[model samples]
Target: MKVLTETWWSAAIGREKTVTVVLPPSYSPVGGPFPVLYLLHGFGGNRNTWLQCANLSAVVDSHRLVLVLPESGRAWFINDARGRRYEDYLVHEVVDHVDAAFNTVPTRDGRAVGGFSMGGAAALYQALLHGDRFSVVASNGGAFEAPLREGDPYEALRGDRNLAIPSTRDHERVWGPAGSEVRRRYDPYSLIRNRDPRHPIEVYLDIGLDDYPRMISMNRRTRDALTAGSVPHEYRERPGGHDWDFVDAGLRDLFAFTQGHLLSA
Candidate 1:
């Protein structure tokens, strides 16, 4: 596999952004375009998270797919009410820049998106909102439910039983003050409920049984919502937790599902 770290100016955010791209082993300028998969990192994670935590090199090499990891910081991959247009930056600027700079299949049928935790929520929201841009979407240990209460914003960052160290304050910046209309607009549950049934994108949802209780509950609720909407999807619960091990294992299945839809399309 070939790895390239690149930066470009994003008009949406009015700043330069960085991204890491992984090309298949057989990639060549003359090899024609290949399908693309955008793998988003979770809260407090950077573009290198996937390469560091998952066996993505092997997966990309085996599948001959191009992978992209974009830096979203704690933006939650959404256009914040506070004036940050991360969602626009990602969908309009990043995607367009990648297609222009690389040998990628520049169509919805050849593109897929997946992520873990916060990133997973972003992936699903983006796919659902812009079905014309993504053919398949997958989530692992996604925090799908909104923080309805004022105190729930810090719950995940605090970790189970308040064991994990917390550093940044993201909730208000991304989703607006808790329980606000802005927050509800970006909530995955709300988005799913309001999704257009006719423009269904192929969905994959997986969460660890041992993951944080909140995460598991959110994923379950997301699955139930999809079922109620009669949206076709693959949902699974396995023995694991919200960690690299769980993400690595889930990625294998995600890649397989993505390949089936992206390559065959």
Candidate 2:
């Protein structure tokens, strides 16, 4: 696989953004376009997160596909009410820029998105909100449920001064104050409930059973919501935790699913 690190100005956030693109050995800008997979990073992570943690390079090389990993900081991959339009930046600017600069398929049928943790939630939100832009979406150890229900372990973490919740400020800025209508609109449960069942997007969700209690609960709740809505999806609970080990364990299956869908699309 060939890896390219690039930086370019982004009008969406009023600053330059960085991204890492991985191309298969067979890729040639003059030969043909290939399907693209957008791999997102979680809170406190950057564009190289997936490349460094997951064994995705082998997957790309073997499948002869392309991978695009973009840095969005802790933006939650959402358009914040505080003036940062990260969702727009990702769906429009980054997608357009990658397609323009490389031999990408340049259509929803040729695209897939997946991530873990904060990025996992963002991947689901993006696919649900913009089904026309992706053929498949996967989330591993995703933070799907919102509003931090009573008894949620995260609630206690929120109040603990000793713990560092990196997403605190960005969550508020992106979704507005907790319990607001804006938050509801971006919640994965709400999005799934409101989505049209006729939309043709394949969904995959998995969470490590030993992950944060709140995260596991939220992922199960998301699966329940999808089941209740009759949204076609694949859900799994594996014996692991919220770390690279779990993600690496599932990367092969995730990539296989994505590759199957993209090829059939």
Report clashes for each candidate as comma-separated counts.
Answer: 0, 0
Weakest 10 consecutive residues of candidate 2 by summed lDDT: 145-154
lDDT of 1 by residue, 1-265 (tens): 7889889878888888899998878776665688888988887788998988657767787885788999777666778767888888878887888888888888888888888887888888888888778878888887666434344545545645623212335465566666766677766767777887656688898999887777788788889988887777899999888876888877678888888888531
Candidate 2 lDDT by residue in tens digits, 19-90:
899988988887668888898887777888887755776777778578889887766677766778888889
Off by over 4 Å in 1: 147-149, 153-169, 263-265
Candidate 2 whole-model C-alpha lDDT, 0 to 1 = 0.79
Candidate 2 regions off by >4 Å? 147-152, 155-170
lDDT of each: 0.78, 0.79
Q: In candidate 2, how many Å is residue 43 off?
A: 0.8
* Residue pair clashes in candidate 2: none
How close to the true structure is residue 225 of candidate 2, measured as C-alpha lDDT? 91
Among residues 3 or more apart in sequence or in different chains, the pairs in candidate 1 whose N, CA or C atoms overlap within 3 Å are none
